[model samples]
Target: MSRPRDLYDDYTPSQQMTDAIKAWEDIVEQEKEVRRAAREAIAAELRDARVERDGVEHRVSQEAVARYVPWSEATVLGIAREYKVPGVRQAKKKAADAG
Candidate 1:
């Protein structure tokens, strides 16, 4: 079989390439900002998250947060920890109304 000729085999940098690269970089930066905002929002929500169990409310579990967000459980916990969200370091065993 013969190898097909590649269109950019002898490619040279051009102004158009520079503009395209700049556009891609801007988009990547914007995406990063959006992801950061999302993580912050998730962390804040986790801080106030709660669930009722056996007639008592408890802080939401990492698994629950993972299910709500698009990321994995570990990612959710990491974000929660990064933001210093409560219940990330140690879960509360006693009922919310216990004390």
Candidate 2:
């Protein structure tokens, strides 16, 4: 069986060869630009996806902790005390409550 002739073998004249080469170069340049743009767009989309995933993971972790941990005001106060930070105080009842 005979192998198929390459496209480069089809061009005969020097001018035709030069034109073909120029056309091929133009095509290659355009393709490179297109590929670069596509890669940049994909990278941006991936970054956005990562940020969204991080936000979702943070919310899920908070929800999981809230579900699993029995946190109370006293517990918060105790933590604050351990950290040597001021904690929340209870509001005093108004005199109207004595009526």
Between which residue pairs do clashes occur in model 2? Answer: none
TM-score of candidate 2 relative to the true fold:
0.38
Mark the 10 consecutive residues where model 1 has the least summed lDDT. 88-97
Clashes of each: 0, 0
Cα lDDT tens digits for candidate 2, 1-99: 999967886656789889999999999999999866654443333233222342442112222222333454454344334445442233456799766
26-77 per-residue lDDT for model 1 (tens digits): 9999999999999998887888877776896777777777897889999998
Which candidate has the highest TM-score of all? 1
How do all models score by TM-score? 0.69, 0.38
C-alpha RMSD of each candidate structure in angstroms: 6.5, 20.0
Candidate 1 displacement at residue 90 in angstroms: 9.5
